[model samples]
Target chain A: MSEPILDRPRPVAARRDAALPEPQAQDPDLELVDRWRDGDESAFASLVRRHHGRTFGLLVRMLGSREEAEDALQETFLNLHRHGHRFRREARFGTFVYRVAMNAALNRRRSLGRRRAQLERLASRQAAGDDLPQSPRGPEAGVVQGELRARVQREIQALSPNLRGPLVLYDLEGLPYGEIARVLELPEGTVKSRIHRARRALRERLIDLVSESDDESEGAGQ
Target chain B: MSLRLGHRRFRDQLSDYADGQLSPRLATRFERHLASCADCRKELGELRRMLELLHDLPAAEPGPGSVDALLRRMAETEARPRRWLSAWGAPVAAAAAGLAALLLVQDVSVSIGLPGSAVRPEARSASLVAAEARALPRRPAPPAPSTAAMLGRRAEFAPATPGAPSGASSSGRSALAACIGSRDTRDCIRYHWMLDLAGRDVPAFLEVFESLPEAARPRLAGDLADLARGSGSATAIADHLRASRDPRAATLAARFAAVGRR
Candidate 1:
């Protein structure tokens, strides 16, 4: 639970960008991709249906808006449908999916238009009198924690996309350094360095949290 | 100074060490450093705590049925023919662009060219200025129908001249679509759509031209190529259209014995 916190039943404020966890040894899902490449369109659909939740969960955190993430999701799979043939099978197909999904999220983010916040949407959801799925300590503690969480999100968003991409992939999505390197077309060492730099920047910005121990906070790591 | 640099290097490895990513030997060395360095221990504890908080953020789920919606869109897109201009090679696209540019220079429909601009906008008669206003794109933005589409739109807004072609109104809509924003193509396309007396009835005249008998394609192609230069013969090319199934082709046949299909 100190790592991936994906076991929630209700909507928690999700992090923005994430990727599917790729197997370090081999890509077992290459057969599914091969089936789609061989004109078994149903395999593609099954992949879309299966992976949509995880890909979208990551993108919403990455793009900072559910609506934009949804659009990015469509672009991701459509790109796969159109150009998945270009996938040389060098990396795990799961890793390839992450690359496409991440690229779509980043490209859509860079596209000349408005940027929206996931927190703003969550606030709207809250305004509708809907309680978030978890984080129930006390109302007073919840509000303060919520403000700190929003600040953390903004600081993460403010990081350069270069630092942000690797950090989100490694820390939030829980992809390994090697898989992240393949997805980002960077050296694994570069990916590790970027993640570390991103972490330091985030830590420096949220340094006040260092004084206040998170170990006592409700489900801080889980 | 050496100890300080060593401490700084250990701090750099702190991220790797906290993630339990370093090799065992490096980890042992880092452990040795951490045993004495209170600063490194405190920093590692803070880093671990921060990393945990980040990991604890909740997940964002997809809206209900987004996958189904995506699949439906995929099916719909597959059903339709692709719309990109990739089919036409660079040469044809270049030719089309050149034709579009040529028509732009001679744009008489909006009177931005010689005959139109001959009279200054300020000095033009009130009635003429009023007529031009309706045709000019001086208002807020419209949709992208693109550069050519905008031109076609402006052409519709243009005031019709006295003694203009007999079927100008009938061809206006088709001309609006076929204009590609060029007055020459608009005039050419509108003229063809105008009469049983002249051009074929295809809205996508270029597409229709592609479908014609190979012998006939070059005949019309020659006319179309020379169209910008104003040297094309519309009369001879109509003879090639006798086999065209369009009802309008009949009028073209009757006129083609005398007129060159320019």
Candidate 2:
């Protein structure tokens, strides 16, 4: 009644040592995977440090809400922990992890439909004369970097999943076309085409933003 | 003059040409075109500039404390003992340990000190042992069939019959295919079928689906559905469903399409 065989404490490190080997000597991901397999608690921690930001950033972009992104990020890591054995070196560790993050974010998006509907209702209410004050542009006012960034983000968000996958992998993650193709399970030609299409779409959306910024700069005589 | 004129076609290859993915001969032709054509040159310049601007987009950074959280999760996962030993580990050592444990358990259970009576003579009989061995046949069992193989076999055996509700036929194969095919019928069929098949052999199906004409989607969907229902093979439905525009029929066809090769 007190304990089950499955719950028996097998030898597992409760903490990772700070003096663990340098990240270079061992492939950090492989090491962490092996350590996790062997019940080294700290190895898992190192892995989280290595990949959390990139994973979080991807979830943020995918979900477009910081709170949702955080939740998705947690879910992604939990999935990784449960499915660590599925990792094989056939794909880059980063690509594999990002794929998991993308999937988790997509799942969250699917589940958030109800919340989206609520938000839409609120948005409709706001449209009917809510007097929310607009925040000023950043310190570099004339540059409109913040505005441009928002425009770019919106344009990217507007892209279809097909185009966005390659676009984000290349532009945000800095993965080469080959890596992007491998990660997305697409042909390199298709990856290139999608990236091109995404770029073209983005350019179309941002033309006004770009021109407006240019006009503003000229008007300011700077 | 014809050769010079034909060189203009190379101008359209600039995107691939720049990446050196183009054939050497075609690349050379494109370069020659680029040298002579001002408009092509300008277009390439614009493309290059646009690409440069895209590259200049800020690199996304990971959120704070996220890495630490990930590591802690990993550590927790690692610390948990696997229910079974992996093939990569020390097999002999594991086997020996397992054998020793088994023997210890047998010894403990059979000990005369236990409250239960010592081994009954009938329990130790050769016939009894043989009967038990026959029932349990402890040699490693054959591997289970993969999900794809099982599904394929099930699909093969299941008679192809229309399962959708009456009105669903109106919205069925042909209509669905028409909707899907109009935008990218081939890709739509491939994607839909792949999803229908739970994402097996996706790339191959995608290629084939993408190559088919949009007008042919409904027919394809109807045939695929029939195939799924095991009423017909892929080849049987190919011709009749090829250009079918009936949504219900197309949906039915797609329902049975070979989503994965297996």
Candidate 3:
């Protein structure tokens, strides 16, 4: 198995802005939502800044394509704008917003069936020729990094929509099972099971990639 | 083996256990089982590794200009003038005047009489008549009854007169009938009554509509569209219509463009 890439330590100093004390008062998101409802247009922009990255990340992982993810993200925000009043603050604003984004992504996937099929076929064809025999990771890990990224992307694309949604939300997005259930409107048990199953399936698919480097090292020594 | 220690049961709870969602008692039992179970241990390890890979995938940001476009759309909608039916039209003017006269006469009759006697018979009669009219099955106009039959019925109650007041105008009845002719009308009426009867029970209405049989869905969709048009709120209706597969309902919903356009 290829050595798992250690996550680069994110700069702690950069997190200072994020760690700054949140207002000791009301929930900022609830306030922003209220402002938007009251027709203060700028309040929505604040919401976008706060959530856009996470929302975009979930979309990308769900779609497995940057362009489509971008489109879905835009639609999600637009939908939020058009239907802001429908939000009742029944749950955390994050959960409510993620649910909306996830639904939008799923709907967009259904609508893009023909295009997606064509793209998948193209992707598979590209994968066949481009599957360079696993390269050894050394001082220059660029090739290994690129190959691993591509493999990850392909495996994500291969997952069924049902499995993919929970996997992306729980695994890629690191959302808790309860929050995922809220977003997907499924029972918490169902969300957890799907995430587990999705993870198992992805590991089985990628085990060869992980093991290839070890096999190569053994052969070289022999 | 304990009843809960079977493989099928374990598999069902495995996801929950992995997610740390299992109740403490069950989790403790499961943890004990996992300590001895090699297969479960390996499975969990593999699953965790996959999750790590998934977590490493980069986040994708939305393309530029999309937010601006959305904002512009919102602005345009906000800036659009609200459309309302003009009250200056002759029919509306006449109707308003008649209603005023009816109310005035009712007030005067109530004021002139003593105590309970002040209750105007006409007003009570009008209400009873309106209730009866509303209760009648919404159907196309039936042929007029023979003069003899009318006279017989009238004689049973009050003396027959050549110019007895009609229960309701034929035109108004026909207009209402036409409105209720389709399944759409029935669904709209059902929703209207549900909403009115409970006051903005939107979730209940949605639940009812969602549970409707496939065969009835198109009609309900049409009814929703009609109601949206009538009420001058088309966004929800349009969203429903867009999600529906029935082309006919979609076409019917398209007619509600005027509601959202303004």
Q: Which numbered prediction scores highest in lDDT against the true structure? A: 1
Give stretches of model 1 more than 4 Å off.
A1-26, A112-145, A212-222, B76-262
Local lDDT at A200 for model 1:
91
- Measured with C-alpha atoms, the lDDT of residue B10 in candidate 2 is 55
Write model 2 residue lDDT over A60-178, tens digit each, in one string. 66655677777788788767766766887776566678878878877876676777857744653353223211322222445455544544455566566677777777656656666
Compared with the true structure, all predictions reach lDDT values of 0.54, 0.46, 0.51
DockQ of each: 0.13, 0.08, 0.14
Local accuracy of candidate 2 as per-residue lDDT tens digits, B38-125: 4455445444444444555565565554454344323223222233223112221222222222222233223323233233221122
lDDT, candidate 1, residue A204?
Answer: 75
Model 2 residue A43 lDDT score: 56
Higher-scoring candidate on lDDT, 1 or 2: 1
Model 3 chain A: lowest-lDDT 10 consecutive positions: A1-10
Q: What TM-score, to 2 decimal places, does chain A of model 1 have?
A: 0.70
On DockQ, the leading prediction is: 3
Two-chain complex of model 1, DockQ on C-alpha atoms against the true structure = 0.13
